[model samples]
Target: MTQTLDITDRTRLRRSHERGHFDRETINAILDAQPMCSVGYVIDMKPYVTPTLQWREGNHVYWHGSSASRALRNSRDAEVCLTVSILDGFVMARSGMHHSVNSRSVMLFGRAFKVEDPAEKHAKLARFVNGLFPGRYEGLREEHAQDLKATTLLGMEIAEGSAKIRTGPPKDEEADYELPIWAGVIPVTTTVGTPEPDPRNLPGVEMPEHIRKFRL
Candidate 1:
C-alpha cells in the first residue's frame, strides 16, 4: 500500500501535491544522503528547533547531544518532527512569484525516546561516528566512560512521513513562456576540499586516501 500523510499546507506550496513522495526507498535515500537534520519540538509551550547531525539504523533515526542540552531534554517522550533537506538548484522563472528551488527534503513525524541501555547506547554511538566517516572509529582513540556519561542519545521511529522533491526547469505560465525572459535551472552542488593538516601536527603525516578522495 502507498502510505499517504497530510501535507501541512497546499496552496502556497504550489507543488505540494506533485512534490510529496511516499515511497520508503525515496524517503530513505534522502535521509541517508545527508548527515544534518533539524529537529522540531515544543518546550514549555514554545516551539524549538535545533540543527544536529543524525544517522539511521533500520527504521530508527539516531541523534546525540550533550546531556545538558535543552532541546534534547525537552524532546524526550514528546511528538517531534525531524527534517533533512538539500537544495540542488535554483529555478529561475520569468516572474518573481513563480521562482522556486530544486530540492530533496524529508520530514519525519514520530515520538522521541532516550536510549537507556549502556551497551546499546555505546553501539549506537559507534554507528553514528562511522556513518559520518567510514573507518574513523578504528583510527581514533576509544571512548572513555566519562564521554558516554556526558552525551545523551535518542532514537525515533519514523511512524509517518513524506519526501518532497522539485527538480528540472521552471513551470511558467503558457503565456509567460512566450515572453523574452531568461528561464532555466542554476544547478548547485557540494564538493569536498583538500584536507589541511593541523599546524601542531607532526611533519610528513600524509593525508589519508579516504580524506583526500571523499565526495559529498
Candidate 2:
C-alpha cells in the first residue's frame, strides 16, 4: 500500500495548507482517536449531514444506523464526505480575528457502500462493539434476526482523505502581543466518567472489569 494518499482537487488544502497532511499514519491516528463523525451526502439535490459513530478496520471505515433511515438509504452507493474532528483547546488571542481552536480533523471523500451480507455484517457489528468495549460483546445476549434486519451498516475505503491539525499557543500580531489582554489556551479533553448501572440489574451482579476500566 502507498504510504500517503493522493491529493486531488477535492482533498487539497486551500488555506493554511501547512496544517494539511495526506499521510496515512496521520489520517489513521485521527480516525482512531475520534469515533464520532459526520457524514455528508446529498438527497433531492439538497445536502444532508448526519452525525454517527464510525469505526476503522484496515483501509476502510464503517458506520451503522437504522435500516429504514433516509440518510443511510441515500448514502448507499453514493458519493459522500466523512469527517472526524477533535477539539484540543480554545486559543484566546488578543484580537477576535486571531482567536482560534486547537484541533485535529480529517475529511474523506468516497462512495459509501452498504454491507449486504448478513454474516459479514454481524461480524463487523461485533467487531465494532468489541473494539469499543473489549470483551463486552461476547457476554451479551445473541442478536435477534429482526434486530439485525433493522440495522444498516455502511462502509467506505480510506482512499481519498486529508488530516488537518492545529495546535499550541495563539499567534498574535506584534502589536497585539504587547496588549494587556489575557490570552492563553484552555485545554479540552473527553473523559470517561463513572459508569451508572441499571437499577434493575440481577441481584448480586457486579460491574464488569472492562466497564470500570474503559477509556476513550
Candidate 3:
C-alpha cells in the first residue's frame, strides 16, 4: 500500500514531517501501545472528532459504540482518520515559541465499515476485552444477545498510516545560545496505580496478580 504521508519534500510541512514516522513497524507499535484514539470524520458537512478506546488485530483497528451513535452510523463505508498519541515529555526552551512536546503519535487513513456477522462481532468483542485485560475473557460471563444487538463494531484496515515521534530537548535560535537559561527535557510517563477492589466482593478476595503487575 502507498505510504500514509509522503515525506520527500520536508520543507513544505517540515515540522509535521520532521516528526512524522512512516515505517510499518513503528506505526503498528504506536497503535498497539495505546488503547484510545481520536476518530475524525465529517457529519452533515460539519467535522467532528471523538476519543474512544480501540484495539488492533493484524492490519485492522476496531472500535465499538452504541448502535445509535451518530458518528458510528455515519462512518460506515466512508473515509475516516484515526489518531493515537502519547506525550512523553515537555521540551522547555528559552523562547516560548520554541517550547514543544516530546510525543509518539500515529495517524491512520482508511475506509471504515460495520461488522455484520454475529460470530465475527463476538470474536472481535472478545479481542477488545482481552486487549484491555488479558485472561479476563475466560472468567467473565458471556455477552448476551441483547448486549450484542445494542453494540456496533466498526473496523478500519490500515491501508495508509504513519507514526510520528518527537523526543529530546528544544531547538533554540542561534542567538539564544548565549542566553542564560535552563534548557532541558522534562520527562513524563504513564503508570498504573493501585487497583481498587469492589466493596461488595468476598471479604478475603485478593487482587489478581495480572491486575497488580499490569503495564503498557
lDDT of 3 by residue, 1-216 (tens): 112333333243344433545366777888888888999998888888989988999989998899989989888888888889988889899999999888888887788999999989999999987787887777778889988899999999865766678876788999997999999889899988888888998888777766787788
Q: Please, what are the lDDT tens digits per residue for candidate 2 over residues 159-196?
A: 77777778878889998988999999998999999999
Poorest 10 consecutive residues of model 3 by lDDT? 1-10
Task: Report, for every candidate in turn, its global Cα lDDT versus the true structure.
Answer: 0.81, 0.87, 0.81
> Cα deviation of 85 in candidate 2 (Å)?
1.0
Give candidate 3's error at residue 49 in angstroms. Answer: 0.8
Which candidate should be chosen as best, given TM-score against the real structure? 2
Greater lDDT among 2 and 3 belongs to: 2
Off by over 4 Å in 1: 1-22
What overall lDDT, based on C-alpha atoms, would model 2 receive against the true structure? 0.87
Per candidate, the number of residue pairs that clash is 0, 0, 0
Model 3 error, position 10 (Å): 13
TM-score of 1: 0.88
